[model samples]
Target: MFWKTILIVFSIFLSILLYRAYVVFTPDKTIFESCLSSTANHSLKFDQNRLRTFQKLLQFQTISYEVNKQNFDEIKKCRNFIKEHYHDLVTNYSEFVDLYDIAEYSLLYSIQGKNLNLKPFLFSAHMDVVPARDLNRWKYPPFDAHTDKDFIYARGTLDDKGNLFAMMEALKEYLHAYGQPSRTFYVALTHNEEAGHSGAMGIAHHLSQQPFGHNGQFEFVLDEGTTILEEVFPTLNNPIAIIGVAEKGYMSIKYRIAMASGHSSMPSAPTAIGILARAVDKLESTLQPSQFGRGPELSLLHGVTPYLKFPLRLVMSNIWLFGPVIEWVLSRKPGTDALQRTSTAVTLISGGEKENILPTSASATVNLFNDFSNELEKSLSTAARKEPLDTTNYLACQCIVTEFIKIIRYTWLSKKDSSLEQSVFFSLNGYSTLNKMIELTVTRDKPVLASER
Candidate 1:
């Protein structure tokens, strides 16, 4: 009788284990898939021909071309092309196109919905791209539209043009079918996003003065930060869309070390170049804060926790346990780990001029990324105090100052609330949609540090 009772208990336990396994392994439905299907059902067409329009847009050399005067003319042509093709739609939805300006070098178009009473929505994409470094390295001309079975080849195809053109095409189709959207939609195509967003900032400033203020007042904004990839993780079966909620603060610092100039034959204990090199080494060796914060990093951790396996899932589900582990993991890897932490890189170095002369001055430019909690001043102060340098001989100079600017934009996904637990669950649902499409496992990785590249 005792053996029979033991057998019954073992059988029940096995059944429960099998049920748990089944539940864990089952594929979950995501809101994005539902939204996509619903849009498709409503005859929301994603025309290949429209995607071709994006390819055509990419064919132009829209590089900022700072020194080239003709770039302004090219920008005009691109603007004209966009206006000509979408003129009818623009005319029908006159209220949507808020023409901000027609400057000599750039044009600004803001798409506002008919419903003025509703809150405003904005989506920004740059019309300019970075110059192609080497034409010889590319299979096709950087500006030439080339296509493979799965990818489109062009300079700005991935960096941003794809995102901008896709967004424009999507909006055009949506308007063609359903007319103007319910909420106000603003699309600003600036000419100088690559070059400190001079044009974008101008538009942003203009918009700021208007009724639509910055922050949560504008609903949300969306821009290209990362792309969706497929088959990235074992647990995830779909592609994940990485939406950047917030961007890291950027700043540039210059370090100058002075040494007596003399003949090459006579060398001092601390040369300018030598001192600068040591400072560069010191800065690179020391890292900034690795702790995760609000916006995308937090959003990402919450988004992927649901799909994590076993012990990891349990730990990730709880903030107290997951926080330290995520911090530690990000600190170790140079790539994905960079997303969560503030990073620094020495971009430019200058010292001696001639082979025979000892240099009198050496300078190095260091770019840094900081979180919202840390401002540019604080970051600089900390680096100056903490970083090991020859302060006696070295005179630190501030070349470029840092400023915090908040971009007003929103993603298709909703924002998270204060509740840590609920926010994680919501982000997980959003991430699942992206994972399904990209087919990559989204992990609690740091954002790519642009300066590092």
Candidate 2:
């Protein structure tokens, strides 16, 4: 009887495994059906003057040095440069568009829509670039916007100015093609995103004071975050854009130890430095518990699992059973490891003065990027249950993932050559992929919000 029971249990287990492998792991073509399709406007060719304007915009030294000490002159020049280059937007469309200088350097363009009932969208980009500290490491001058046969080499070419320029150009193009949009939208360009978000906060404060800010009534807000990643997944052949649903929050813990000082010749059993060192070592050795299959990364993995090859697809699809194995593998690499759990980094440590004397005090600071997905989930669920109409609570969590595409200067590729299979990634002829989003959405007869995608 016992032998018969064991056989039956084993047979059931085998059946379950087979069912999961074949049924659960099967590809679902409909998964990304809601994602935005590349529209015809993506093929629009940018003129030489527009490319020149992009290159000139990159030449500005609007570097954020410190919170109080920023290169304001360069920022002002950049703002003026934008206005001068897009003369049509400022002069021709002055009635529909209103420009405001928030926190002195930040620029906010409020474009009025024909329909007042539609909730406006907000798009944000930062103007200032981090200082180019290691000039010797750069192949070209950091601010030069050097154009080779393929790429434009500059500090802000990829980060934010690229997005900013693309947005402005898209707006101008929309006006020329479709005229004033049916849905209202706002573009906010902050001057000090790298150093501090004061400019952003100023704009936020200004918007909050307006009538639309009452219930967070906007359609959606798109801000700068992660870029498009190529070869992010090992088994997947295609590049995936990471719309960051949310960013990891961080906390810092500072440890300080104080002990009696003595000569090096006669040391105590545990000195202050020794105690601190051991504590730091323990913290380093013990990692935070992995939160795999719990966060937005789970959503990401599920979305991409069908595209991944063979065993990986099977493994990702059956995360409930293979989570520990996948977690172990993911934890091996720093970049991939961060996606699995909260990460710890000992950024600062200091202790002694002279070699002869024993240190009296020692301190260490450990920074942790917390996996706050649980908290976020709860907040989202609560907001949805309590107030379905008020989407302000949901705005912070929605994000876009896109690859940092190559920006080809002065050269435009044909539609056939520019396909993803050719691996061109995208070009700046129309406004690259990031900016093309704005162009496609507003220009379409029916506006498609990023959240819907």
Candidate 3:
């Protein structure tokens, strides 16, 4: 009787709609997002001191977010603390300058090298971090920078502050002892990378005029990126560190719908909530096809083929033969599947203010990472339902009001070079290992997306 009751309840959605045919074929039923790309070579020395400093840096309440953006006071406090602690390095080791006049938001520190013939190297990290809320859920106060014998937890612990402080401390040590190396060092710490990057905007404007800032040749730019997963892929024994040598393009679209408001007891033909829900579900369900056979992800997969287990390795080695099957398998997990296609994320939805009354209007926001070869306009046109399609297969193949969110250039995970292309993977050894460790075990599954050239 209980089994029957459970079946009856489950039948509501099962009868209404079920997953597409593709998901059923993906076996192993384990999480695939934890998988990554790496070689046996990645190595960075572990240090308890670095972890301690990260905890101290995390203690600073440098919370930055989009809405209710300004937290200038806390930002200044963090900046001042950095200056005070690293006074010797700031005053003697290099040229320390503020990129923004407003509470020292964006910052740049430069250490000139002995040999100008070798190109300079750039290291970048954001000083600001996303706000940590829901205090009750946190193991420790989000800004308290709690540290156990092994783990360090805080607001910016993983998002960025840990990165910023570690670099600064390493820079101070390097400059204090060895002075300068062959490649020049440009350390850039922006004020609010978490919120909108006004600090970065200011720094860019500053770099535009200077001869070395933007014009000078650099060995390679180092930014946040991919990690090394030990064995998420049942096939690999060695950890895989996916270093991004390039990045993807991005765009955002907003949709809104309007309808007559009414009480729950009396419903209308098509309510605002119903219209918006249908449109979003349709937009996502009918997404673009996977591009692993040709995309950058294929390049990384090809590189990792030598490390995969026997049968899987054989399959991965010849993607030309097994491309569709592999896509079907990986595409079930958004984290890996999205890497090969123009990914879409329906982030925000807003509608009714009250439970009893049906709202008159509703809106949804979608963020998309468009493949480099595809145009946003074309992708939009393809995704748009209005231009004659099989109406029976999808949600109302019609849309209402739409808006575009104008965005500044933001850096994310970079692109991996294909077998045919030249790569900058070995350029910055220090950061390569540091980044590997960060994403491998420390940062978990989060990796920032980036643009190459």
Candidate 4:
């Protein structure tokens, strides 16, 4: 009887494995099939003069070191360059475009479209870039704007300037090509986004006073995003661009403990440092609640499952059966882990000054990036449901939803271990590549992208 039971168990295990393998190897129609096909070739023209102008912008040292500490002259010069270059919108089209200066340096352009019925949207990018520490480590001067056969290397190339310049150029091209758009939109260029969002806050306040700025009036707000990554999936052979839909919330907490001070020779049972160390360790070991399936990541996984190769596709599609295994694998890496749960990192620790003395008090600073996407999603859904959408708005809404999922999907999948090649490529080539890509994508998918929904 025991031998017969063993044989039966082995047979069942083999059957299950075979079934899983079959499921993994087979292909089926996916909802994301439409997005996979290549669309019409729509390209943006970027002449050498445009590249030179971008290089000139990079030459400016608009660095933000701290609150009230910035290269004001450089900032002014950069703004002047923008105003001079975009004279068509700033001066010539004054009747249609309204430009406002917020927080002295920040810029806001409110463009009135022909259509008044459509909801408006906003696009934002910062003007200031963080100061380059350890300048000696740079291949070229931080503000030199060195260009080769394939790249333009500079300090603020990737941070904000690339996006900002690309956006401005795209807008200029659109206005010149097709005239005023049907939907209204706003462009906000914050002066101090790196040090803080003070400029952005001021702009927000100014907008809030306007009638259209009432809460939840704008259709969407597009801001800075992750890079277009190559070889995101081990099996998938394509590059992907990730848009940041929502920003991660964060907080830094200082953990402290007080105990009797003593000499090292006669230390107490539990020293303050020891206690603090254990607390820090416990915080790192005990992770926040997993929001894997409950968040947008699940939708992301579902969308990309069809594109994934072989066993990975099967495993992702059958998440119900392999959730714990997948979670365990993801939790092993810090980058991937952040997508599933809040991350805790003990950044700084303080204790004894002298080696021979036991510290009376010990403290550690823990920085945590909160994972509240599940709650945020629910709230957003509720808010969206409160206002009924017309067909145009609904399609627009669907496009936004599809794009959001694609963003998260690419971000999640690409959150793998970075290679030296990736680091070097991103350092030099990423910014310029991203600029052209965004210009092309925004122009190409202006309306057709809605159909992908």
TM-scores, all candidates, are 0.74, 0.72, 0.72, 0.70
Query: Would you list the C-alpha lDDT of every candidate in the order shown?
Result: 0.59, 0.66, 0.58, 0.64
Q: Is candidate 2 or 3 superior in lDDT?
A: 2
Distance (Å) between predicted and true CA of 397, model 3? 8.1
| Residue 214 lDDT (model 4) | 45
CA displacement after TM-score superposition, residue 86 of candidate 4 (Å): 1.7
lDDT by residue (1-453, candidate 3, tens digit) is: 999999998896443322211232223424346656342433234477666656666777777766247577888877877666777875574353222243255667767677767776767777677767788999988877777877777787666776678678877766655566666666777676655535554544444444554345457667555566777576677677877875665555566555556798887645666656776777678777566766677777766665566567656665656788888988888787777777777888888868989787777777767764555554555655432122343223232112111122222223432211111222221121111100000011112223311
Ranking by lDDT: 2, 4, 1, 3
Write the residue-wise lDDT of candidate 2 on 342-420 in tens digits: 6767788899878999887777766666564533223223322322111231112222101101121112233433132
lDDT of 4 by residue, 71-184 (tens): 989998998888788878867667678888877888888888888778877787877889988988998899999998888989989888998999888787677666677888
Candidate 2 residue-wise lDDT at 212: 62
Q: How does residue 260 of candidate 4 score in lDDT?
A: 58
Quote the lDDT for 451 in model 3.
Answer: 30
Clashing pairs in model 4?
none
lDDT for position 372 in model 3: 49
RMSD of each: 11.5, 17.1, 15.3, 17.5
The model with the greatest lDDT is: 2
Candidate 1 local distance difference test against the native: 0.59
